[model samples]
Target: MKRLMFSVLPLMVGLALGQAVPASIPLTATATLMMPDGEAAGTATFTQAGNGVQVTVQVSGLAAGNHGMHVHEYGRCTPGVDAATNTIVPFGGAGGHFDPGMTGNHDSPQTDNMHGHGGDLPMLVVGADGTGRATFTTDKISLTGENGILKRSLVVHAMPDDYMSDPSGKSGARERCGVIERDSFETRNYPLPGPQDFPEGVAYDAVKDVLYTGSAANGTIYQIDAKTGNVIKFSDGGAQGRNSALGMKVDASGRLWVAGGASGSISILNGDGTPFKTLMTPRTPLPFINDLVLLPDGSAIVTDSSRPTLFQVTPELRVRKWLDLRDTPIEYQPGTNLNGIVALPDGSALLTIQSNTGILWHIDVASQQVTRVMDGLNNGDGLVLTGQTLYVVRNKDGVVSKVMLAADFKSGTLQINEPLRGLRFPATAVLVGDDLVVTQAQLDKRQKGAPETPFQLTRVKRF
Candidate 1:
């Protein structure tokens, strides 16, 4: 071995045994340095070692120079850098290097030479060609457990690592960064063990103790046996019916409400798969009907991003109230798209506002008042109320935070349950008493015009 010194230690090891692994974690990442600007992008691959990890990173497209690199306190890397200071700050609020021991001090190879802080790593050097590669290992990091490594972030510094510097690298600031999160074994192109196939849309039927999923590509609804994970196609709703059958909700009355996106219609089905009623949106008009939620008073709230309005619908499939985001005071800007809907126990509902603003709005059904609940969230997609705590899922950031519901829903506190890591574009969520039913929607951008595949449905039971 040449013993090349690089930063962002790679802890994942490549296995030649060929045995299938359930979860593969990202142990290493590489980055290139853009000269004056100090911008970069690269890929990191994580592998498993004995009871440890190994990582390999190859990054290119940089300004060409030595860039400081260190594992950050959070894994999410977005918006690039801090504009004012132009430094690398962790998304989860840079909590002193990843030192589980409460070390409180940054150690370099020379200065303290203690090898204490998880944020300490070798520097990455991007050559004149704007490329860099580094491979290293760290036994102090992991994906699971209270002392796991990735609960922090990996940041790229603007200057070269001095190796003997204290605290920060003296490398100016962090130009690029990415938060390390747990990798789900249920991804398609990513690969995992067991049966890696899924039908399509997921619906929870407590009475049946099974999950019903519809496949738009296959034009069939598969009833998945919960305990066994075996799937059997239950119904054929035709090509159009299957293609548009994206959102599904089971009301208290046991009626299954399906939103036919491509078909521009809503179909109400009996528990036995009988179609009781069908309501379609206009043809010549616009907007795709994305989500629907049946209220307690026999009313439904529907969302159409194309029209970009939340409409209150009657049981007879009539539009009763059209809630335009522009009219609402909850900061629904132009680019922000609305997604999931959940009706609270007190008749209020929370709507997902997918925007950089990261806002979750509370809507009072009786008064039609929209209150800004929380902010600083990216892709505020799924909202679910479990007991007195409300969990909001952020899509782009891959985080699920719990919000407390005090006397009035307005001035409550919020805290993140750091354990539930590795979530990308989390869409729908349901409360099975205290446990959460979360659906992971991973968009595969590898193939052009290809719909994302290999979605995951997870049941997160937190104590």
Candidate 2:
């Protein structure tokens, strides 16, 4: 009997001979439900499964009864004044039910055709303990495509759905709401022109929609079309006294500022790769100018890995040793002392990372005072600051750590370390849209022998 049932199952589901099965792509989203008083309720999750979507919901702190749950048009869960009642309503900003097909009818999840709302689902039943759990699959909704539910809201109504009513199944007020957000994970690689170029720094030109990368093996600057991924040599090797380009940035004047590693120089070039200016730093201490950050006032601050100092370029293009950490709380080690630098949003202070000791330092731009902020980031090579968040790229670890900095720049908490699979000695990164294009310098492989041919950059999304 079991064998007979198995044989007839394929026919029951309308399976055809030699039919190709669709591949299931990994896509997921989650939402945290909150009550009107900002109280925690429960959570809901959505996952792509075959040709359908799997939904799991767990709710608590509600009356023991049936409730209507659905996806709304907007992701907002804030309270707003209701037009009909002229009173403030909870989660009213979520708007109406999600109806991509503009269907005016409220029906069941098993409803055929596009006559019913896509967000309609089965009724949720709460137990005596005021807790409810549901797990189901529906073909009417999806995580992508025209009926994608990303950035939408999941609402739980006060009353159960009748499964056959106009508009919203006559469901009562929305008691709990949560915005569904996608879990982003995407990676791409763009090949460079040289076989052993060993690119170090990356910078993006938002206005021109192009990307620029520098070669550490030589001084060649490569320009890449952002949309097409086409590469072109912007400048030849050793151009404008740039023996090695370690860090780079494009200022507001559309000029590219290149950090000359070991050459103790800062080379400025026009957008067309013409020579603008080259400022040489103190050659004594064997200056290894590694990375730099442009300030809001058109000035720039660069980190020196070999020396215990940071070089600043004034708005008048004058170079000076802005802050020296020799007498400060930040202890500088022997190898690669400071690698990456970033200025805070308010321009009051700056942040730099030490590669050898893994200490993060905060410096006051006005007083030039330096203080230790955090540690345990050994091998931290590049730094990117967005608001109060800091992204630290650890070269040897092959991972980028996301850190949440305190408002006063006194402390920071490490969030998560996102690993790049094929990353080889990543030096620095620049934001392009919602992605991070990391320069894979491959310095470790270069030291061993002939590094990998045709060096490339890795583009990571949602890292």
Candidate 3:
């Protein structure tokens, strides 16, 4: 681990096959190995590198020779008696082996073979002093995405492996086991571009390994290549007249949809600066289109801060008024009603009323009927929904709340992490790998004087 930290690394293109890989983050997963007799064996730490993973193993009380080390499919270590041997096998519940692609071959980890299992790891060698310490790196495993090994189990074999076995090597019984779990720490902050421009909306494209954010001053969209940390203007949003953006999202099609704050239009742009499509909202007095939620079919439910309405844009590029939250007590702010919106697989949306003191409202997209989800958001600016967890960015509070939601959207009372640090009035945010790339919009007026520094995006690690 010390060598890896000081050595210079090269850019990695990732695995052979095209996969959904999240932006890189410093992830370290540890496994405390315990023998069948409950003896402390050792520990393994998997830290994510540039485009690969660096595994550091420090073990004691092992034989002074080569031993098999593999990541098992299941994050469990069950003790069961093997029928053939009639002996208790420790870590039996860890399953056969981790093969995200089900490639039934176990090859040498040093090889450039793409047909091998994702969990194929290098061998571990113990010294004459009964201590094993080594660091190995591989591009097959990642910390995020479908093929990630974050939740897998690391196992040590009772004997050495031949390295060319079909499923697993002749490496005997599973000895020590560790289940990979997320470990968190404070993240380093990266500043955005403009000072007073206040970049508002943010989105992430995992495939491209890039993040896109829009400015509230010029409606220009800038793409930040996560790998190289290169920031460049991707689009001027000139096609959409008066394009001042507030919220943004990249749909399944990889197209960028930006909400026109006062322009009252949704501008669609390709990954490049080219124009894709545009949906115009009904002209209302100072129509403030704040945020939007997308459906699987490419349709979107948009929030209008000026009007007590929710706008729907069909996949066919047709725009229509969907719902109205007129009568509901939504903590209405004339030009800033709803700020952030999260769409569910069930077709409902959870919207945050920024001006209403972080009041979240759940609206049935179909019926337009609204229900209060929760309150006490602590100056919630933007929202992100991953699985069942709802992360609300509290701009004024200078932290992020990781909220676990109940099955019913009507009520979501859960424990949140002790607020995260290092955010200066962040606004819109999107998840990329382990980092929540957010726009430091400073819309909440965190700074009293001039725009302190050039506006910059904040990359936060959300657990």
Best by lDDT: 2
What's the lDDT for all of these models?
Answer: 0.54, 0.78, 0.69
After superposition on all C-alphas, the RMSD of every candidate to the true structure, in Å, is 14.4, 20.8, 19.5
Question: Could you give candidate 3's per-residue lDDT for residues 8-42 as a string of tens digits?
Answer: 24321111112222324344557777776777788
Candidate 3 structure lDDT: 0.69
> Candidates sorted by lDDT, descending order?
2, 3, 1
Candidate 1 stretches with Cα past 4 Å from truth are 1-201, 214-220, 237-242, 282-285, 330-336, 348-356, 417-421, 444-455
- What's the distance in Å from true for residue 191, model 3? 3.4
Worst 10 residues of 3 by lDDT: 12-21
* Total residue pair clashes for candidate 1: 26
For residues 177-259, could you state the per-residue lDDT of candidate 1 as single tens digits?
55564454222112112132322245778887766655433335556556565656555556335454556777787777776
The reply for model 3, stretches above 4 Å from the true place, is 1-185, 237-239, 327-335, 348-354, 417-419, 444-448
Please give the lDDT score at residue 50 for candidate 1: 38
Candidate 1 lDDT (Cα, 0 to 1): 0.54
lDDT of 2 by residue, 83-143 (tens): 3355678998876777755666677877742677888877788999999888887766666
Clashes of each: 26, 0, 5
RMSD (CA, Å), candidate 2 to true, equals 20.8
